[model samples]
Target chain A: MRKAFALIVVLVAIGSAVPVILHWWPMAPDISADGHLIDQQMASTMVEVGSAFLLAQFLLAYFVYRSADRGTHENIRSIPGGVKLAVFVAVAFVGAELLALGMQGQRAWAIQYFSTPDPNAMTIQAQAGQFAYYFRYPGLDGKLGATHPEKINEGDQNFFGLDLEKDVAARDDVVSAELAIPVNRQIRLLLHTKDVGHSFYVPELRVQQDFVPGLDLMVHFTATKVGKYEIVCTQLCGMGHHSMRAYLRVMPQAEFDDWLKQKASEQ
Target chain B: MRFKIACAATMALLVFPSGVWAGTITGKVKVDGPTPKRKVIDMSKEPACAKEYSPTDPPRMESTITGPNNALVDVVVYISAGANDEGVMPSQVVTIDQKGCRYIRHITAIHTNQKIKITNSDPAIHNVHPLAEANREWNQSQTPGAAPLDAKFAEAEFIPVKCNIHPWMHGYIAVLKTNHYSVTDGSGGFSLKDLPPGKYTVTAWHETLGTQTQQVIIGGANETKTISFTFKGKAY
Candidate 1:
């Protein structure tokens, strides 16, 4: 019976480790990019620490079971010293956990908020709508054409309609439906919204940003892979939000230039 | 500037530089078969969503048809021109609105990178969801009388738009890379405007009818043609 109990406890311990093992051995892409490597490492350490705690409990259970099985009439052994040590270790572990959490939180904050725009980065303006993302390039002006919040309408051929009547820079703005980027280059994205709030998320590149009206938020990332990827708006903007898809083509610099030239000729 | 505008207008009519060639593709996207009964927009799962507005009641969907030959409105029938040669806007914008918790127009044409407008006219808020695989999934809400929005497709995808708050609110935005396209009207009729004089493959797509492709040649003025698409199963 004692052996059976010990075996059962061992099986339970092993059973509990399955999820931790799978989590440590993830096959899919991490949405946090490489930032989550630390998190995964911490999680693995946490699993080991939890296994130690479980082992301690199992040891105590074994001792009790053995005493009962032997039918002894003596008093239980006192491990006050060991108990105090365990408590101390637990407190220290908690403190370490809190410290790690704080460090991770700060890193996330810096990545999300404190980073400044790169001066030589390729910039693209993105506007979120009911179910789509409208991308605008400054053409040769290096600036967006005038677009007033009220003057923009998809109807009447006034899309992103930045009241060219009012916003002069908008007069020569070139708008496109697709988004293209050059490989190995930092892409600075300026996010805006014409109607509702939407989230711009790309899973393969591990980048997500929000497009909010009245305020412009920026996000930057470099494409290491030269291929086509889906640029989806994760935010629920409206009835058509599910269909809000954009294409992100990461190509060699020369190909990207050729594409730009073709687009310019169309204008 | 006036001469330039007139020159542009004349060019538009000339059908050469404007690419407004001859031999146009015209037809109706009518429901030639049995149709489904019209039901009110479903708002059961979202209980508090009803409270955001005045009366806690869902609006009736007048877009639904209850006849044998009821045309599927808002069904985007467009030409898949192919991936944009560049990031240019090769297609025109198709406007689809949300009025009284249901999608307006019922059908429209969609081309790659074509802009889409979603407007809300009702007093209550509605959550719009685009459950697309080729595109990213998204959900957004428009408040009562919110300003119209501008949406553009980044890739070629036939993405259907719906309302999460109101499940019955459904529509489609067909994204193709082609310029030869048209949306079927209430009578199931369609039109492909302004083609450069050339031999091109014309295609018609319905949200329910799958797609049909044909080859035609354009020479000069508006050339009218008729093409009909039939669905095998009953339309719900």
Candidate 2:
């Protein structure tokens, strides 16, 4: 019975680790300039945690299998070092592992959160509502107009509630349903929510941020590839949340200029 | 035999007339008691629509557009029972426009087989999501400069339509089986012309106020029955 139980435990451990080793469901390819750091951090954590899991399971199985059926006359055996020593070892190893992981993550974390965007980073405004995303671009003056929540009429398609009639800066602003940026150029995306909380997540870009209601947040990233990607809301806002998504289009610098010009004309 | 045949022929002509039904039901809907102050909509964040107002003249809520003398502007009156309408759904299309972030006709009724068109006249995108129980629920996004969307409901129901992107955009589309319906105008006076002389359960529906029903029996030729629905005022 002991041998059978040990064998089952071993089988379960191996069965779980096989998928990760074989990469059955791997992540989408990273297309952003800063994705390498995040990928490295993720891989290191997985390796450190995975090895711990496999070792713990194997140790448990080995102990079960090695346990003996002794007569009443035999003395119970204690572990080699005692509870205090065991506790010390656990604390030392686990503490070291945690410290190492945290220290390793600083590199990625600093780049994502601590550092400010570049001076030449193009600025864009993104608004997330119940079930959709609307993006705005600063036009000729390189300035985004102030927003009026009441004037955000969907019927007039005047989303973002820009006062075009009076606000000269807003008259030329370009709004689109998709996020388009020049490849390799830093993008400063200012995130705002119309109503409830929402999150902006893009798997390929390895970028995720949340939009708190009544608060504006910003994230910056540079896409290395000229391709189309999907931006989805990870936060559950309401009934239509599941369908909340927008597209990200990365194009050449000249093409982006032309695109922005066309979009501005459409405004 | 000759007299009996002549009487039967005259009765048949009255029952199945080649001309339109001459009976009419006309009346006014009044709201009783004190009226509620219109709730001012806060559009401070929406600068486009907010610029039109100031601290003393902010935009007011428009859920129920009431006229002078307590007349309900958007009430829909129709035949609810006891009338057999065998005519086909009208070939004319029913159009609803999205303008200034509001539905052009707040309350619209169309026949079961009739077509309803939704157009976006504003510069923003409007997501049309209809909350329907008896019929299939559908949502579609209409973008500026895009073609208008057209659809029809097979079953009879009163569906509340809203713009998901713009929470303030809301209206109702009453999918009805009868073609003899009248949506009350600004004066709260509605006239249902050509209602055949017979029995009918007349129903008046208000978006804010509840619905009311009255039974009318038209016994005379080309009868003109007058009826009125009085609803209590809502403060909120």
Candidate 3:
């Protein structure tokens, strides 16, 4: 009987280690924006909860099973401090878990959606269309030029329909097919849409924001990687939704300056 | 004046076939053996799209032009290197209508520099977004009964066109340098006209099934060649 109980303990230990071994395998990793943080939290919680329950249940089962197997005529002797120790340990572990959950939840809530951009930070207006996003820079003057929504025509070179007669700043507007941002800068994006709803998702940097037509949304991110990444539309806008892809150039400050100059010349 | 000249040329070509010294490249894309399995278009994200239409049927959707009967609607048929004029006649205008909230023709072929007149016949406003690497990306909106949106592609590329409002709306614009290419019918058949006698690599391409290249030698003018390409299955 004692040998059988020892075998159960060894079997349980091996079973519990299975999950730990599988974690290192290259599984389907989440590649979406905000995917890293969520994946890490989920994986860690699984390990913590799994280990805690497995250890507690294994001991409890062994004790109950061993006690039952004792001869019917034998009188059972209860350990004096066993119940107290179990209760104390269970409560303390649960309390610790609750505390950790509360702290993590608070941090996630605050960082995910509640924060506002710095007042002096750079702001760019993003307009989501059917198949591509049209980004407009606020020229030398840091204010949006007066736009007449009635006259937006890409064929006639009036894409953002700036009332140049009324707002001189609109005439100097710089627009590009690809988005270029400087690395290590605090950037805020003001997103709006002229047509159907589209989502702006960047997996590597961990940011996904939906562009609502009637309402404008704001997204902020600091580019850490200095390579070109794709800005894919997660939300299906139309038939061309799958092909509605754009390039984002994250470059050093000098190269970004040169690109801006080249775009300015074309505009 | 351009129409009158083209009419006169058509009559002249009909009277004297040997005058042009060009061979007719004709082939049919027969959806043979068994009707190829229809692809299930994933419209899960679009709530307002018409649910009654089975995905197995080509999406009855359009932006500038409607596709040929539900069979691969946006198949781009073009002549890469061919015996044709470098300049396109501006007077030849092909009007692709967006009626019934869809494009009239699913596949449209245009000369590299030729203009395509896109008219929105529906009452609501629609934004035309062309997905193409060959041309500058542009999105423009057209209202009902408004003056047609005349747009042009400066280079040769297969541009997938769509409307932002209708998530199911899809079509393709096959911009070719030569004016000799012709789109296949529902049976997967295509015909290229006015080819000077020479050995040419004839190819058939589908949006779903990739391109199948075949070699053909054309010796006699106005020669008819029967070529067939069968694709196993297409990967999404």
Name the candidate that leads on TM-score.
2
Ranking by DockQ, best first?
2, 3, 1
Put down candidate 1 lDDT per residue, A133-206, tens digits, no spaces.
66777777788776666664332224476665456676556565568788878778888887778998887666
Q: What is the interface RMSD of each candidate, in Å?
A: 14.4, 11.6, 14.9
Runs with alpha carbons beyond 4 Å of true place in candidate 1: A1-91, A101-112, A156-159, A212-214, A235-241, A264-267, B1-236
How would the docking of model 3 be graded?
incorrect
* Model 1, span B190-236: residue lDDT tens: 67766543444566665544666666544445656665555433522
- Fraction of native A-B contacts kept, per candidate: 0.00, 0.15, 0.06
Please list the C-alpha lDDT of all candidates, in the order they appear. Answer: 0.62, 0.80, 0.64
Q: After superposition, how far is residue A62 of candidate 2 from its true place, in Å?
A: 1.5
Model 2 lDDT tens row, A3-25:
88999999999999999989899
Query: Between candidates 2 and 3, which one is better according to DockQ?
Result: 2
What ranking of all candidate models by TM-score puts the best one first?
A: 2, 1, 3
- Which portions of model 3 show Cα errors greater than 4 Å? A1-102, A157-159, B1-236
Residues B1-236, candidate 3: write the lDDT tens digits: 54554454445445665337556776655332232222223232332232534544534222111123323333455455433344654458777887654566767888877878999866556778888786998888786679999988888777877777554456678777777677776545577767655556666666545677777655556676766655544211
- The TM-scores of all predictions, comma-separated, are 0.45, 0.60, 0.43
Q: What is the lDDT of residue B234 in candidate 2?
A: 61
Residues B1-236, candidate 2: write the lDDT tens digits.
Answer: 53553454356456775346677888988888655444444332223434645657544445567788888877889888744563457889999998766677878888886898899877666788888899999999887768999989888888888888655567889887787788888888998777655667889988767899998765554789999999887643
Q: What local lDDT score does residue A32 receive in model 3, on the 0 to 100 scale? A: 33
Question: Could you give the CAPRI-style class of model 2?
Answer: incorrect
Runs in model 2 deviating more than 4 A are: A68-84, B1-160, B165-236
